[model samples]
Target: MSVLDRIIRTTTADLGARMVRIPAAELEARALMAPRRPSFAAALCAPGLSVIAEHKRRSPSRGAIRVDLELTEIVRDYERGGAAAVSVLTEERHFGGALDDLTEAAWVCGLPLLRKDFVVDRYQLLEARAAGASAVLLIVAALPIRRLEELHGAALDLGLDVLVEVHDAVELDVARSIGARIVGVNNRDLRDFSIDVERTYRLLDGMPAGALVVAESGIRGVDDARRLAAAGVDAVLVGEALMAAPDPRLACEELACACG
Candidate 1:
């Protein structure tokens, strides 16, 4: 099986166990269950291209990136530095992140938070809501059409925005078929973990109009974000580059300026 397949399979099993550990009702009772204040989509449409700064410690490919930065300090800086939103990695196995990271970021930073994870079940959506996330990411490569539609609907019911990630044309088509508007073109190929920054531009040719496009992964510097913003993406979700920086706030500011 491909890496994507294996990751999804493992995610499915892990999610099943996670749900049992924290029942849906229990998650709903968390203080964060109330709808988030800011809107990620609204941030995307702000004056310049948006920046979804991240709080991540590691990844499947890069291993450890920022294991020491506390969520309170990192997220506060992102918000202070004018980040459009914050994308907190919630997958523990591959990304040295946890649900507590999401909750902590939300508690610290008032900006909208995207629960970045391989979401495959409705339970996770509810978990996101309870964690004070204003948005959730749904990878088109991981779900079939029916399940995608189901999860999207559930997210809407919870007052959460959905950013559907697509790596290529086929998945993009599936995302559109499911009526996803906020689309993230991931530059990293999950199968082999290879990155081609040009993937966003290449895929932009076939993207449907009216879909808010976001470039995800492999964005390492100001120039990378500048190129993507020049290509007309609504925003960029940059994790590793900023997290690994000595000053994540400065990195975020540079990226935000690059959008111009």
Candidate 2:
């Protein structure tokens, strides 16, 4: 099986276990009680290229980028460095992250939090809201069009923004079909986990005009971020490079400044 297949299987298994522990009704109740989060979608559209710095512990491709840092500290560092938003990798098995990581980020920082996970079920959306996430990532390669539509609607209903991620023209059509306003173009190919920064350049012109374009993955530094900004990307989701930097706050400042 490909890496994407493995992620799907792992997510499926984890979903079952999570539901058994929290149950859907309880999760929804928690969401209903939590304070409303501001529009994470609007933050990306602010003038100049916005930065969505990521808090990722490990990945299938790269192991343990920053195992020593605390979520509260790292996310606060991102905020101090002028990140417009923060993406918390919550994929557990593959990414070595948890829902509590997002929760802690939200608790400690004022930046809008995006739950970066393979969302196959609505349960995850409720879980995210309960955990204080203001937005969630919906990968086109992970779910069928019908499922995507349902989850997209469900997330909006809960007052959470959905970053409808597309990898190609066909996926962009699916996003448009659901009226997705925030668009993320991932440079990494999910099937084989290969990355090419030019992938965003290739498909971006085809995206809907005025849709928030977020370039994800393979952001190495200020120069790479500047290239994306020049390409008209509204924001960039940088992970490994920032996480591994000797001074993450400085790294974020340099990247954001480069975008400007």
Candidate 3:
């Protein structure tokens, strides 16, 4: 099986187990009781190219990235460096992250939280809200068009902004069909896990007008973000680059300052 296939299989199975423990009804109740989420989509559309600094302990391609980072410390650093929003990876097996990582960050800072996870069901949306996430990622390649639309609608119903992620033109169409307002162009191909910054450029023209676009992955530094910003990107979701930097705060500051 391809890497994407494996990841989805694991996600679906894990979601099933989680459903048994907490139940969707309980998740919904918890979400209803939680405070209203901040607007993640608006954050991207702000003045200059906004920076959505991401927190992740590891990845399938590059394992164990800055696992020692305390959620509160690094997240506070991102905010201090002028990040517009924060993305916390909550995928368990491959990313070495958990929902607790998001809750902790939310507790310390007020930045809108993106629950960066391989979300396969509506249950995950409720879980995201309960964990204090202001936004959730909806990958076009992961679900069928019908399911994608369902989840997209579900996110809005829960008052969470959806970052509908697309890798190519066809997926872009799928996102558009759902009337996605916030679109993310991911540079990494989920099938083979290859990286190419041009994916964002190649898909830009296909995006709906007035949509807030975020360039994701393969953004190494300020120059990379500048190149993308010149191409009309509204925001950049950077993870691995910041995780590996000698000084994450300085690296984020440079990107945020330059992009703006």
Candidate 4:
């Protein structure tokens, strides 16, 4: 099975256990109680190609990047450096992150906090809102069209913006059909965890003109950001490069400058 298939199976197993522990109504109640925060889509849609700085400790593809930095200090630095928004990786199995990371970042950083995770259920969406996430990621490769609509609707009802991610044309079509306003073209293929920065360009032509676009993965430098920006990408999601830097704050500043 592909890595994507494996994740689907694992997610199914986890979902069963998760449902037993936390009732969906309670989760929805928690989502409803939390104040609706500003969306990252609003933040990144501003003029230039914005930098969506991320807080990630590890990835299935790259392993550990920065296990040393504490969440408070890291988020504070990103905020200080003028990040358009902060993406907190909340995938525990693949990425060394937890839901608490989103809540902590939200409390510390004034920027919009996006809960970056494999959202396979509506429960996860409610969990994200309760954890203080302003936005959530919905990977097209993970969900069928029906499930995507259900989760997207749930997220919208909870006042959470969805960054629907698509690797190619078919997924983009589904996103558009489901009224996804913010579309992310991930250069990295989750199936085998392979990256090709040019993939965004290949898929850009088919994306709707008015949709907010984010170029994700393999974006390592000013030149890369500039290239994507030139192609009209609204923003970039960067993680590994920034986390690996000795001074992540300065690294973010440099990347932000590159986007300019």
Candidate 5:
């Protein structure tokens, strides 16, 4: 099976167990009581190339990325470095992340948080809100068109921003069909885990007009950020490079400055 398929399979099984334990009604109640979060979409819409620094422990392609840094420290550095927002990888099995990570990041940083996970169900949206996330990622490749529409609406109904992610032309069409306002173009092909930084540029023209565009993955440093910014990308979601840097704060500072 492809990596994306495997992760989704595992996520579905794990979600079932979690729902049975906490129940959807309980999650909904907790979400309703949670404090409001900063506007993730608005943050990305700020002038210049906004940076959405990600807190990813690991990935299926590259394993064990900065496992030592505390989640709070990472997020704090991102905020200090002028990141527009933070993305917390909350997928446990493949990414070594947990829902608690989102809660902790929210507690430590004022920046809007994006719960970056394989969101296949609405239950996860409730989990995100209750955990203090301002937004959630809904990948086009991960769900059917009908299901994607349902989850997209569900997230909005809960007052959470949705970063509808698309990797190619077809997926972009699907996003456009759903009228996604915030679209993220992922550079990495999830199936084989190969990355092409040019993928973002190739897909840029096809993005819906007036939509907030975010370039995700394979952003190495300042130059890439500058180029994407010049190309009209509103934001960049960077993880591996920043996470692997010896001084994450300085790395983020350079990228954010480059975009500015």
Candidate 6:
């Protein structure tokens, strides 16, 4: 199986165990009572290329990425650096991340939060809402068109913004078909975890008009951010570069300036 397949399988199994422990009904109740969240999509639409600084502990391709820093500290650094929003990788196992990370970021940062995870079920949407996330990610390569439509509709019904992620022309079409308001063009190919920054550029023309465009993955520094911003990208979601920096705040500040 490919890396995406394995992660999805593991996520399914783990989600099942968690569901048993905390019933879906309980999650729903918490979601309802959860405080209002800031507008994640709006944050990206502001004038320049917004920086969505991400908190990622590690990845399947690049493991052990700055695990020493506390989640709250990392988020605060992102905020102080002028990040438009924050993305918290909530997948465990392969990513070495936890849902608590999103909760912690939410508690510590005033910026909007995106629950970056393999969302295969609506239950995860409830989890995102209850955890104080302003938005959630939905990768087009991970789910069927019908499933994507269902989850997209479900997320909207719950008043949560969805960043529909696409890696290629086909996936971009799928995202457009689903009326994705905030579309993220991921440079990394999920099947093999290979990254090509040009992927975002290649797919830029096919993007839906007026849709908020976000470039995800493979963003190395200011140059990359500048190029993407010039190409009309609304935002860039960067993780490894910021997480690995000696001073994540300074790193984010540099990127944020370049992005704008």
By lDDT, who's the top model here?
5
TM-score, candidate 3, is: 0.98
The alpha-carbon deviation from the true structure for residue 124 of candidate 4, after best TM-score superposition, in angstroms, is 0.6
Q: Which stretches of candidate 4 lie over 4 Å from their true place?
A: none
The lDDT values for all models are 0.85, 0.90, 0.91, 0.87, 0.95, 0.94
TM-score of 6: 0.99
Ranking of candidates on lDDT, top first: 5, 6, 3, 2, 4, 1
**Per-residue lDDT for 1-260 in model 6, tens only?**
99999999999999999999999999999998999789998898789999999999999999899978999899999999989999999999988889999888888888999999999999999999999999999999899999999999999988899999999999999999999999999999999999998999999999987899999999999999998888888999999999999999999999988776
Residue pairs in clash, model 4: none
For residue 259, what is the lDDT in candidate 4? 76
Over 4 Å off, model 6: none
Model 4 / residue 130 / CA error / Å? 0.8
Output the lDDT of residue 22, model 5.
100
TM-scores, in order shown?
0.94, 0.98, 0.98, 0.96, 0.99, 0.99
Residues 1-260, model 1: lDDT tens digits? 87788878878898889878987777767634465658878888887688899888887788888877788999988988778999998887777778888878877788989999999988888888888888999988888889999999889878889999999899988888888879999999989889988889988877777888999998888887777777788898988888999998898888877774
Residue-pair clashes, model 5: 0
Residue-level lDDT tens digits of model 4 in 13-128: 87778889989898778878987677778898777889999899898888888888898988888877768999999877778888888888878777888999888988888889
1-260 per-residue lDDT for model 2 (tens digits) = 98999999999999999999988998899998999766688889888899999999998887778978888888988999989999999999999999888888878988888999999999999989998889999998899889999999999999999999988889988888888889999889888889988888998778886789999988888888878888888999999998999999999998888776
| Clash counts for the predictions, in order | 0, 0, 0, 0, 0, 0
lDDT of 2 at 162: 93
Worst 10 residues of 6 by lDDT: 251-260
Residues 48-131 of candidate 5 have per-residue lDDT tens digits of: 999999999999999999978898899999999999999999999999999999999989999999999999999999999999
Better of 3 and 5 by lDDT: 5
